[model samples]
Target: MAPSDPVVDPISSRLDYDVGELRRAELAADPVAQLRRWLDDAGRAEVPEPNAMAVATVDADGRPRVRNVLLRNLDEAGLVFYSNRLSAKGQAIDANPVASALFSWLGLQRQARVDADVEVIDGDLADTYWANRPQGSQIASAASPQGEVVADRAELEALVERYERDAEGLDIPRPEHWVGYRLVPHTFEFWQGRRARLHDRFRYRLTGGSWEIDRLAP
Candidate 1:
């Protein structure tokens, strides 16, 4: 019998809508402030996992990888998250030192995209965040070998048991391989959905250590 030809899927059609009817009064001056407002609103709405975002990183060879990670922290300096330094995402960031973050708050019909340069945070900062984690999470961090393939689930379970027994009545030290990183934003774009698809797009770019905001075509 002849082998069947490989099947390919076609891209979906793009949706069209008027993007000019959205309100821009709040986004006229500073995009960062507007982002903060939206984030606070998202929290007030009790959106499930409001801090969850898709983080994209590139490898040394320019291959891109994306995954969902909890937004551990955020500020004007940048956004922060923790991971095992030896993990795939960590290694990719180490090699490329560039990343992008996307936040989609569908309930609010808002999205935010951030393109940034990444750097591993200092040991002291990582330690401070580690100290704030729940005891169980700290224990799990010590036990699990993130991004490393194991024999099976049983193997991981065994490791967890051993670590738990050893950590009984004691503090689990943060592993050297586990730490936090920050992405310093070079550019940010804010999108707001509107009636009749007339959305609002505002972009802020860093130029000469200052931010310049501009309206973007939706």
Candidate 2:
């Protein structure tokens, strides 16, 4: 095939982001509030999985890993997400509590980065969230040994079936391994894409019980 032939050529892919500008005057004084504003914008724009974020953690072996996690709760205290304690991310967070989470609202050409130290939420809170989850998800989270090697799909289906049978007519209590963590961010950076790759970035730093915003070079 000729190099110029479109059939054999590399698939087309590129983005010339030209989203709305992010200015200090338009931003909320608090980073959390600013995040909420962007979230609202993302929702209005019909961005898929607006609350999904890429959580990054480093294992004991010094390898970096990133996975998508849903944002369950957000407050001044921290950003909350849940995971099974036996999962790779859970183990990594336990080993090194410091982590980073990134929210890429590519539909709006915006992103948010958070660098934080994490702590497990109270048992009561975890219970509350677990109780609200669908029965199937609860059973799956409780039954499956996350991150563990299994024989096959059949093994998992069997485990789920067994758990469902055992949980019949009874409340499936939240497993100890199924817990929530709140990431208390010390730094947050917000980015808005622009034409010609001249983007806008603003970072908020927590200091002396207050937040200070600093504009960063694109």
Q: Who wins the TM-score comparison? A: 2
Give per-residue lDDT, candidate 1, residue 7.
71
Per residue, candidate 1 scores C-alpha lDDT tens digits across 84-150 of 8888998998898999999888777788999999988999999988988999889888898897899
**Backbone clash total, candidate 1:** 4
**Could you tell me which 10 consecutive residues in candidate 2 have the lowest summed lDDT?**
5-14
- The whole-model C-alpha lDDT of candidate 1 against the native structure comes to 0.84
Model 2, 1-218: lDDT tens digits are 65574654445655778868888898899999999888888889999999999999998888889999999999999999999988999889889987899999987899999999999999999999999999889999999998899999999999999999988999999999999999999999999998878899999999998999999999
**Residue pairs whose backbone atoms clash in candidate 1:** 18-197, 18-198, 19-198, 19-199
Q: Candidate 1: list runs displaced more than 4 Å.
A: 1-22
What TM-score does prediction 2 earn? 0.93
Q: What C-alpha lDDT do the candidate models reach, one value each?
A: 0.84, 0.92
Q: In candidate 2, residue 192 scores what lDDT?
A: 98
Each candidate structure's TM-score, on Cα atoms with residue i matched to residue i, is 0.86, 0.93
Candidate that would win on lDDT: 2
